[model samples]
Target: MIQQTLTQLRELRLSGMANSLLSQIEQPATYEGLSFEERLQLLTDSEANDRENRKQQRLLKAAKLKLSAHARDIDYQHPRGLKQSVMASLLQCHWINKAQNLLITGPCGSGKTYLACALGETACLQGYSVKYYRISRLMLALTQAKADGSYSKALQNLAKIDCLIIDDWGLEPLTAAQRNDLMEIMDDRHEETSTIIMSQLPTDQWYQSIGDNTLADAILDRLMHNAHRIKLKGESMRKIQSNLTDGEHLE
Candidate 1:
């Protein structure tokens, strides 16, 4: 029995142990005392803990990025076949410090959202804390918070993130209160943290969309002053793909 245990331990790569009864082994080596089933359970528990540790490390790595995509993958040379210098310049990630915002304006079907999401994804990967919220969803969340008397906490939470990416900024009309809320959030983040505002409307029209001149001024002032504006060009990637594939592939 001792010889058999020693051989098994050797084969298992458990060093410094020979075949010893389960009762005689000390801790750890005692772990070797248990039956194969018990050992398997311990191994399984250890694997699970290792997996969780890896997952947590990945999450931590994603949160530290300030500018999500590094410059090379941005396709600056091609510009997706458009000749826009500004788009390339924005990829440098320098504007983040100027309390500058990113304003992405382009017609629907263009790569506006893709570009914005890519940038946000890059930021996450680079270890900068980022918060991604769709315009409609954010408004709904704020509305819910107001109803629940947690609006202050919600706004404070928004303020804490290092970078906030608001996708689809003008998909719906904003109420007076929502406008104020947005302005306040932007105001707090202005010149302090970085922001990415993705909108289909042109910069000139943002004022009309928001419906309050004072709030609009406050919002745009901070956004444009330090912002690295990128105006994407070309037909919507969606339409182009649909045309190529005859709409057979549904996204």
Candidate 2:
């Protein structure tokens, strides 16, 4: 009878409850003291928790973050100008809920990408949809989507994400087509979702990188309005953490 009930629970897709019941059956002494309501509540809680864990895994996989970073794993001792107070507020993900943007600017290897990915992971844990893209790759994807006749659909999908992390911003000058594509994406996401932009150049220099008078103005207006900024300043963390000997440098 117990095996039949377990089979039924699995068929109904209540694997969490089924597993919990199997454990209860194996250790009857542990759960025998509980009332029927108490046992039922435990099964329900286990199923809910299992569902939440599965959802988080799906979100993280779909996010495609470059780094496996978490908010609690951020290194505060790295001396990269990261403030605990600011990170504390950001970790709460209230800005994402408000559809605000985050700009993280710093020298290369200063952990900008890690911090952005960390915040993105936090958003995923909080049940927000996130996607990460390098500026060049995203431009390529947009161009490909245009050629494939799915450009509009791509833009619509991008607009629906709760948090979008754009890494390596301003690495190269933008062409006219890429500029237009960026304009479309930014316009779609403006004031409707959150974005995290990681750049080596400072914000003021982004205008020159965009290389257009009119579109640059429009893009910056939408992107920078009410956005939170984090400017990291320090030596390359990679250099500091390297195990390579100074005398054994590779060409």
Candidate 3:
């Protein structure tokens, strides 16, 4: 009878439940205290939880976040800029649900990318699809996709994601083609999907970095409005870590 039940569970693709049942059979004492209905309920809950865990794993794998960052790991102890209240609000993910943008600007190693990845991880944990890309690499990939005649398809895929994290925005001057490509991406995602941009340049200098006046305005119009801004103000986090390491070594 138990073998038949295991076969039925395997056929139904309830592997989690099947495994739980097998464990119970292997060590009957483990579940001897539970009633029949309680045992069934426990197995059912295990199956549901297994499915959720697998789904979350797939989403996190696809997110491609640079750091293994989480909302809780955010360093509020060493003041970067914004208050804990601001981070708490953002962590709630209301902005992502509302299809807004988030801009994180600061000098190199100022923890901008880390914070962005942390938010991206949060989005993933919330069951939102996410993709991470450095601006230069992303443009290159787009250019190659265009060469392969998959540019339209690429944009469509990006448009469907719940959150898009673009690191190193405005790192270099943009060509006309790059400007147009960026405009298309911003236009497609605007008011539809959320975006997180990490940049070293201040917001005011973005227009100059974008190069083409008209296209620059169009891109910024889509990104800047209806977006939250976070400017990290402090020395490079790397330098701080290095100093801490030196102190530890001396001790």
Residue 8 of candidate 3: its Cα lDDT? Answer: 98
Q: How would you order the candidates by lDDT, starting with the best?
A: 2, 3, 1
Estimate candidate 3's alpha-carbon lDDT, on a 0 to 1 scale.
Answer: 0.90
TM-score of 3: 0.91
Q: Candidate 1 lDDT, tens digit per residue, 1-251?
A: 76677578658754323322333444565575678877766655554565555554574454433234443455444344434466555555556545568888887866665666566555554445666778888888999999999999998988877678787777788999899889879877877889888888888899888888888888878778877676766666666556556466667
Off by over 4 Å in 1: 1-92, 243-251
Model 3 RMSD, rounded to 1 decimal: 2.8
The TM-score ranking, best first, is: 2, 3, 1
After superposition on all CA atoms, what RMSD does each candidate show versus the true structure? Answer: 10.3, 1.1, 2.8
Q: For candidate 1, which ten residues in a row score worst on lDDT?
A: 15-24
Tens-digit per-residue lDDT, 155-210, candidate 2: 99999999999999999989999999999989999999999999999999999999
Poorest 10 consecutive residues by lDDT, candidate 3: 242-251
lDDT of 3 at 134: 95
lDDT scores for all predictions?
Answer: 0.68, 0.95, 0.90
Q: Distance (Å) between predicted and true CA of 150, model 2?
A: 1.4
lDDT of 1: 0.68
Model 3 Cα shift for residue 91 (angstroms): 1.4
